[model samples]
Target: MGTDKRHYKEPKTLPDKRNKRPPKRFRRWRLISSSKAVGRFPVLVETIFVEAIIPDLVITQISNGFLHGKIPAAHLPIVDRPHLLDTVVLCIAENPRFTAPITNVTAAVGREAILTCLVEDLGNFKVAWLRVDTQTILTIHNHVITKNHRIGVTHSEHKTWFLHIREIKATDKGWYMCQINTDPMKSQVGYLDVVVPPDILDYATSADIVTREGSNVNLHCKANGFPMPSITWKRETGEMIKLPNGREVANVEGNFLNLTRVSRQQMGPYLCIASNGVPPSVSKRIMLVIHFPPMVWIKNQLVGAYEGQQVTLECHLEAFPKSINYWINERGEMISQSNGRYEPLQKSHNYKTYMKLKIEHVSQSDYGKYKCIAKNALGETDGTIQLFAIPKPSKLLNGIDNDLQDQAGSLLQDKNYVNTASAASRKFICTNFLLVLSALHRLQ
Candidate 1:
């Protein structure tokens, strides 16, 4: 076709850009802009071009004159008519990124706990919470996906995401992951530790024990809970415990307490304590009773009394499992409570007793060796006391009177006897008075 002089002119060919191709990295992109028509030609007032390439795009992006893009083109085709773009809307989005690490959480059983994940530069990507151990997805963005009602998800300003768990249980303790749906998947993990209080098992623990003296014994304590419970043994009375190795301590640790050659001194209530880091420790009280043969101890092995006087003989005895105590005469016959003449009484405390035999209106027959006996299931024991008679007060006084009379008569018949009181006579009289007092004391 021939060019018209006024309507058309020769088409200008730009030699540098006609067959130009973008670098291999960008070779498949095209640009679009607004333009104004001038006769039959258009002119560009503002250019819309991508400046840089983004290796990956997570989601959609909006542009305002500046744009981040990854296209196969170096530049857009040029136009001659009036082309302009007042506000170009080019969109480039960023992949979700973690600004802060996920924080670990800890809570006791039946309590609430929270794990936080901080993310920045999150475009349209969705964040999810997963159980690392079980590979179970707990929450996606703000929606919970787990069947557990105690689990929930929350977020603050689209940056800080939280995984909420109410009434935490031991089974819920593990590692949890906060993940983003990126090409390679971005994730951070935090641990959730759930603590549990101690609980003692009655069936597996020791109960009240009754053993013989010099025997070996073992006290066992068992408990259940998270983190495992530690067992300790302590005396309820706060007394030191003699370990099997002969070392004494106020408290012992372990599930088994070994006591070697246990004696009466070691008999009491023992406590088994179970404890963990959690609150409200538990304890069990076990009574230990040491049984032994009856033993008798005499305070006074020899006792004396005058006729028609009352006297008491006592014996202290110790035994476990209780003891049968009685008083016996020299003939080995158990003394009976006769017409209120001979009174036998027994006063007992735990494993101990005081045995008394009171002889009222004591006669010559009552003056003999008497025995106190204690018997128990283990063995029997006895203690003896010799009860001797003393002269009556009236007879002793008469003898003293006769002896004084003879001494005075002999002094008066002495040829050298002085009518006036002499030093020798006064001395003898004082000596005689002292002798009479001593005799009266012995009679009483």
Candidate 2:
């Protein structure tokens, strides 16, 4: 037994292969093939994060749950140390995806606006903010790339990114993009709607309108705003508006309110209202006026005045432009205010006028036909009133001093029936004389 133990010896210990570093090419290949961390372009891993990945690979293993990439390495155990590479590899295992979609943002002008993009498992990929319509890059990662000083970018926990716009303007409204620089360029889009209260363009819109009756008229209302406002035409007095087809509506849609043939019934202040579901809708007041020639009408075509009596003849006139009103005698002479017996007066409201001719001390000369005339830019019109003498009952009774005088006086005192008959006969004689004179003048 002592002789067999003499040749025993300890075997040589072999070096640990896991502790030895592999070749540079072999390490790169291992990182590229074994994990999706490097992806197609390995260089991106070195540039994306705040704590960038080292180009030279650092051997590490997971500890607890968190990567603890920034913590001191001296505190971690050698067997269970953690590094940023583990974080990259974990994030790479699950591709970047939008946790929540970017929502459409409505912002008022001159106000601050923020747009957020939420992502998960972003890994070494980059997040960029872009203006889709303009193809302008606003921000890349944590840096603002646009020259606009109002723009800014912020990131939170490597998951949420924000693009801030200060003092937003009308030009900033459009489609915005939140993009992830992935293999196929992952992207999500949202609209930036800048809401502005309706504003009517005064130059293009209609002002106070003055057109002739039975003429075509167009009222235009132009507005400038986001979402393109809609225009409505309405009466300011809350009256129903009449359309070209004879249909009446409370409110008419479209920018132009076309009236095929305008009339006096349609003259008033029209409201041009503009709205697009925004606050503080705007409106403009446009006055529409209808114009026509002068016209005259008289209630009584024949008037009677006795000797030593006073009488007033009246004429009602309508005209677009203010008309000059006066009274003319049977001899075609305009009645003058200088005369102490004849007084011509006129009162007007809008397009209507009341013309009066007061004849004091109505004698035989005043008992004849008188014309009330109205003159304007459009045309002229006149109305005639026949003035005839009505005999006084006392004078008629005195003229007949016979037996019938008592009967005539009694009848005249009862109801003035005799005077009424005499007035009728005088009016007939005057009318016949005027007709014969008119015929003779026409022949001449």
Candidate 3:
């Protein structure tokens, strides 16, 4: 045995494969294939999170971190940790707690909004902030994906994730989410309620409206604010509005007010009010103006006035823009203001006007057609009246027989008449009158 042991050379310790010179490619392959850390990169986390797989790739990722202990858990696949899952029923008992709750946040326009999500034992996990309404991702851990420059994000000690939104807008009011990357991913929702007073948009809403009568009136109103303000129209004068079809209303609901066949009755200041239960309800006053041409009417179109007597003519007119109202003769000449002999008077009440023409001593010249004229920049119109003379009565005649006898004797005395009346023709009329007078005396 001593002699055999002397021959044994310590089994010439086999060359250590690790220390031996190997092919570069084989060494590189071994280095890559053997490392659990490197192998971890190829596993798709989304698939593991969505579907079940052997070894629970998420657990494996947590067990073996990818980038050698960088604080950023991004390098490690986000997966449901077994401990949190194991604590499910017990979680109620322990309530893997939140350091601070995700609470309701209120912010004004052009201001900053901060939503905080803080938790304890949030180990080896990620927090994501999302908008509940749109399901929009606002923040993920330390990253913010919102394209708006006003959006930002921050985190503290891997336990708190904050979503900072700058220059908030009216549309930014809604629910938000704080999510933890875990199996059955833990999530908490927070509401971000934005508040803003109402504001009117130019060019979109209505201004002062100038339209003609018998035309369609389109009044549009637009507004912007948080909580989505509604628009309503009301008359500033507190009067009811009459629709085209004779419907009367005090307040109309909608952004657009359509009144067909508008009339002067529809003219006034209309208030467009917008309110969303926010502070300071706002309103805009738009004037609805109506315009039309002048018109004239003569109540007494014809008149019979005795000669040398005073008579008056009258007319009524309605016009906007304050018409130039006056009287004209049949010749179409504007009657000039004269002495008491020819006078014209006018009195106005809003759109209505009264006109009168007085002739102190009415004559044949004043008896012809007369006109009342009304004119404005919009248009002109006129109405006419006519006058005539009444003839004077004759005085009662006396001594009718004497006058007849005298007239007959004068005719008989004319030599020309005697020659013209040949034969017995001249006696015919004379004899007939004499016989009629004798017969009347006998009857009496």
Candidate 4:
């Protein structure tokens, strides 16, 4: 196409951009002009080109923003283009970045716990700690935001943010988030696990138990703590334990202890131990008291001896609350241990008692029915024994030529009692008794 220069019109004046009206969104939020002062020279504000107008872009207080970029190659040829009066130059600070990741924390009750959030280039941004479960803000920058006194905040090098919790409790266990305030908010979360030791529940556990002997008994114990505590049972006196099935065990390993055919031997303090592999394992002590009536049985109910010989009468007594045991003569008078000639001996072990009365000279008065009595808090019991005289023998009385042996020998019988003597001692008793039975004589 050939160019025709005929009737060409030249514009007299260009449209003035100064009279143009501003956009409606710029009326509420606008930027002012300024010149950036370099170290030695000044950067002209007119050189700033708007790369983009971001809608509703906010950085801290900057609600409306304009992205500044280098001038395009096509814009250099336009000499009379519109001038940009929006001169607010922004050198935006860096957004907070987590330099160190949040590590999972495990804390004990009543101990101090710390949560750290290390940020590298946190220029004007802030670091805040918020509870993930409760959504409660704990700390903001170097200042604590929550109402809790146990929560605290600290910072170092204006980057590392630390949330220090003092005297941590079990309720503080959960996820905690570390947040940074930037154009688009950033956050990281870490878990807090709180551990506690075992604690015994006194109101639920058994106390001093008082029951009758030969009755079945059950002991109960309970406890509460973190990680679900485990309970065990043990006898305080370290005696063999009698289980519910009539079996003996060294220790019981559960919260409940069953004792079958209970007796005074199983009566004492019982220990209830609770643990969960945590610190401060705890134990509770309970007392088991048994009650029963007094019981008495004679070892030797029949006795025969020579006139100048010594004789001993024995009785076995068993009772709870320790039975008071004594020996009584045929006249119904209790024998006195203070008398040297008529000695009464007593030996005790737990609920068992042994009572014996020994007379130095077996006179006619000592050869009668003797009684042993026992009394306690429950009731009383007694047993009787008989003393007999024999006639003198002629030949079989350990040598008839011996005059004293012919008229003084007699036979003694232990009334339905088991003899726990040695073989030699039993042989000696048999020889003397058989030889002396032939020389017995009754004396009125």
Candidate 5:
């Protein structure tokens, strides 16, 4: 078998190597070719077969297998989202700034004025107005613009801010502020000047003048102006008289002149001057008339009465002016004639004039008619009242004796004394005899 194996050939067949899987298509490839002699025994050999070709299988399957794109698992990364930077943006539509001079403004007591501010480049910002002295925020934004009714805010056509004041008063004169909500930056400031006008001269009417002697008189001066007017009084000699309390009497409260307890020397042409800071001072001259009634005269009267009785009498007086005065009459004489018994219930003063008399515990002596006499510088008046006296019980002796007799009889009956006093005395002397008789009686 070994000698024959030298020439014998096997039939040709594909090599087993071809049956093994080929390397990946992306790897290298090789080609194999074979030829055989016709008459000789068929020869067999193993060789590799490969072709260099485009990878068309995968491309063809992908193109023809599906309609469009395919969606993978949901684990995809996000690429687009919005991010927040700053939270809020504040902007002012207008910026307020201004300047005001101190000398130019003039305000009346009951008038109003405005302070103007130029606003520009606001840029979404909020604008507010405030009073500098009071630190009160007057307006906010475009609103007309204050919680206070006295203050108002207005915007001009040219974008200017104006502060309007109503009924301007003395206290309204001050500095004001134009504020914007720009932090770190301070608010703008403006000033206001209020000038008061001089008070006009007040005219004096006949009704405004009062005339009296040894009494108070009031003179009123009527004037009108931005500032209230002050009044002063001067005599023709340009001398100022000492007032009731010795203070300077030239100027009275409001526009008034007062003269207390007028005297003949005080009667003259008096000048009433009215002045306010603003204009020419004005004055008025008038003559003072003093007329009063005569002083009253009182007639010291007497009234008589017994003890334990009420007495009333009248005090007669004659005078120019009628006034009231009462008399305190006791016994037969006027107790008020001297300051010791009769005292003034009220003292006389510059304002009031009256006197009073009072008597308490009226007795029979006070029963006589007493009088209240009213006297004034002009005239006098008298009034009288009658009183009656009542006798005390001691004066009635007969009735007292009768009461004593009845009391003695009542005492005797209470004592049970049926025997006479002489009989009682005799029984005391016969006590031994009575005892013997008592024994005989007992035996019976």
Candidate 6:
């Protein structure tokens, strides 16, 4: 009766004054055991239980069984599952990439050259400019400008993209591409050369150039410019001339001017200036004149005969500018000249020009025709020679050998048979009969 005397009584719950703590109860079972001893043979004994505590509790018991989500049979070993987004996508696929190629380009036909392209990660780019054989679309995306009226794109307030070629022809020479899409490719290529300048076509002067009278004049100015044309010689009171001493004044290599030997106080009026640097410079003007003529005269009379007999001639003149004299008419007309004889020979030098008329011992009256007179101060001329006064041939062969013996004694009458030689011989009996027939024909 005492064992049945169990009193069970206890029921008191009150403490909910808006609660303060106590509210964590989730338990269904708990039991865990494990032991191992090899040398002593405690083979196996393992058990583990702790209900409902798995939020990933050993991966929810390895996803509840049959190696469900795998790994957890309990030899205790399993870990490996943290793929931070595939290791950041394989470290960005083993990084190393960049692209941009093309540089330094220039052009000049009508003139204007400036085309540059260079880029490297120009962040979020679309930048474009093309003409690569008229793809024509130049520049887009970054502020849209695609009207190639000779192209013009300049931005450097940190935007960088300059390609200005306003006026460049020859069909705008080729290849000008600058694109940037950037992924595995970005590009640049510039090459344009168009330069043309040189054209000048004609200029001239020269034909019988003569300048004398104090002497100094050279007028020759030619032109045709392209890369050549530069000649200057001036004097119209703008003086500049001293070219001559081996002369070679250049503007194309020595365009002559040697006013050194020219006086009349150096006459003026001359200009020859040609410029090829292009810009109006061309000139020509010439005027120079001077004259000369005066100095000549000679004439001194003289004539005589006999003494080997032969002489004749005359000459007379004064000075004013008309003269040219010379005559060795056998030497004898004293005025002044030497070496062809004419002594005391007056007049030394002043351009006596030269003159002649002389005769003093050229018997036979100095044989005819003699005269060469030339006068000046403007006028007078004459020339002639004629003189014959023979009588010297060994006294005319001794008077013709006494008139040929008085005409052979007036036509002989044998006049003693011309001195008797014949008459006396015929008497020699025909001279012994011709010397006895020439001695019998010389004894046959």
Backbone-clash count (model 3) = 1
**Per-residue lDDT of model 1, residues 149-234, tens digit only:** 99999999889999999999999999999999975688999999999999999999999999999999999999998779999999
Give candidate 5 regions above 4 Å deviation: 1-104, 120-126, 193-230, 234-274, 278-289, 292-444
Highest lDDT among the candidates is held by which one?
A: 1
Question: How many pairs of residues in model 5 come into backbone collision?
Answer: 42
Give the lDDT of residue 140 in candidate 3.
73
Query: What digit string (tens of lDDT, one per residue) describes model 3 on residues 1-444?
Result: 012223223322333333233334322121111223333232221111111122212222322322221122222222244322211000000112466779889987778999888877665456788889988886777787777677788877876777888888878888888887754567888888889978878779999988888899999999988778899999998989876678899898889998999887677799999988777889999989888898787655545555666677888998777799888788877786755588888899767899888788776777799888888988999888877653321111122355555544444343233224544755664464455445435545
| Clash count in backbone of candidate 6 | 31
Q: What clash pairs does model 2 have?
A: none
In terms of TM-score, the best-performing candidate is 4
Model 3 regions more than 4 Å off: 1-192, 244-246, 302-313, 320-322, 336-351, 356-368, 386-444
In order of listing, the candidates' clash counts read 17, 0, 1, 11, 42, 31
TM-score of each: 0.62, 0.55, 0.42, 0.66, 0.31, 0.21
Distance (Å) between predicted and true CA of 293, model 1?
Answer: 1.9
Better of 2 and 3 by TM-score: 2
Worst 10 residues of 6 by lDDT: 85-94
Question: Candidate 6's residue-wise lDDT over 1-444, tens digit each?
Answer: 011113222224323323122122212112122221111211122122222221222321222221122222232321122221111000001111223345555443566766766454353445677778867767664443666566776655324566778787667777887776644545667777554332322345433343544565555656654446667666666544445563433322335454556643345456666665545666666555433333222222212223443232433443333355544332444234452422222233332333333334444434544444554544556544444342333432342335433432332323122113344544442343334334434545
Question: What is the lDDT, from 0 to 100, of the residue 71 in candidate 2?
Answer: 26
* Ranking 2 against 6 by lDDT, winner: 2
Candidate 3: deviation at residue 148, Å? 19
> What is the RMSD of candidate 6?
30.7
lDDT of each: 0.73, 0.72, 0.65, 0.69, 0.47, 0.42
Error of 6 at 150 (Å): 4.1
